[model samples]
Target: MCENAAVTSTDGQQSPPPAPVVPLTDAWLVIPLFNEAQVVRGVIEEARRVFPLVVAVDDGSRDDSAAQAAAGGAVVVRHPLNLGQGAALQTGITYVLERTDANFVVTFDADGQHSVADAAAMVQAARDEDLAFVLGSRFLQGPSPVGWLKRLVLKTAAVAASHTTGMHLTDAHNGLRVIRRDAAARLDLRQNRMAHASEIIRQLGATGLPWREFPVHIAYTDYSKGKGQSLWNSINILVDLLFS
Candidate 1:
């Protein structure tokens, strides 16, 4: 549902119509924010155009990420100390479930890598198909434009996660997902780091609920690239997955 509104000025001049209001009020966006003060505000503001309810869980950022997120029309939840992405995600999810009546929850990255259109599509698909979960995959449509080494690591991780979770996935660490309210309530993410990616897949797979992977494009802009995870973090995730 979309609606455009216009207003008339005092001098009887018609003002330009505002952007169409998207009717995705039943879904809430959960953004795990750390030191993303530069881009988090823009991301939240853009996403709010479609999904009005957005909650940014600030994971003890040393910057003004919380303030920026609030300014962008998102409800900012702060963690006094850096608890990592997984913890932030869990906090956001819990907030949505406890404080709102949202039927769906969308986990979106705060670095502007995720597209709001894709997120909305995933939610619509889930509602149409009656699925409990809709996970994002970068390699579902074709090969993603990732570096050779990073591609290798991601593929290897996907294979390992598939074997462990018994869910065939092309991209194991994509951070865009839609979870129904009941499904979101069932999630209990304990891994407080990048390892939570694999853990989430495993837990969601264990739910035995209907789920599908949607192809999503990740924008690797100069700013996002600069804030991307480090090689050591990737290595640690692999190690955690292999052992845990």
Candidate 2:
């Protein structure tokens, strides 16, 4: 949780990281799709512009999510049954680690809530800092618009997670993240549902992997809002955390 200013990439003295000379050939963007027919293709197409490899995990969606993702030129992987987002992410990461020569992987949202520019920054930051994981935080420096009650609940959950993980995170549930191959190898996420977020943080805290957070914008459109977690689901996440 503490920033080690002394360990930064320094050519001579304290300095910024050099430009990304290292090609991102093995770095893949993973988008877990669950009936996101309207925006899945668009997201994959845009992501392909920044990343050469894009892996979409179709989490047993009833709709044509897998077809649309394939049409968008992403390597589509399908689960015979509807697994949760966490399971889908694990499946996609495993696919890259085992199927390709990927050294890094990013878990991204398929609902068009995430931005490509921010994701690029995160990937660069992870490389520069030699970090295991880099998370995107809406509270970093952007205009995060959420309802008062929803905001309060989310904030409370984040605080509780920070206490549990000792990471002092600004946003705990953000889906935008980058994980290096080494870190991905270390991660063993058990939670298959929303609680997977907490599971990730807990594991990172236990392992004490070098982690950082960057600013990113999360657009809450009417469609995104409709697809977002309900209040009851949030409560269920808390309950799961308490028991597990």
- Which residue runs of candidate 1 sit more than 4 Å off their true CA positions? 1-21, 228-233
Query: lDDT score of model 2?
Result: 0.82
Off by over 4 Å in 2: 1-23, 228-236
Q: Which tens-of-lDDT digit does each residue in 92-180 have in candidate 2?
A: 88988888877788999898889888888888898888888898888888557866655666677789889987888888878898888
* Residue pairs whose backbone atoms clash in candidate 2: none
All candidates: CA RMSD (Å): 5.6, 8.8
TM per candidate: 0.89, 0.85
- How well is each residue in 5-93 modelled by candidate 1, as lDDT tens digits? 57779999978788665669999999999999998899998999899899999999999999999999999999999998999999999
Residue 193 of model 1 has an lDDT of 83
Best by lDDT: 1
How much is 217 displaced in model 1, in angstroms? 0.3
lDDT of all predictions: 0.90, 0.82
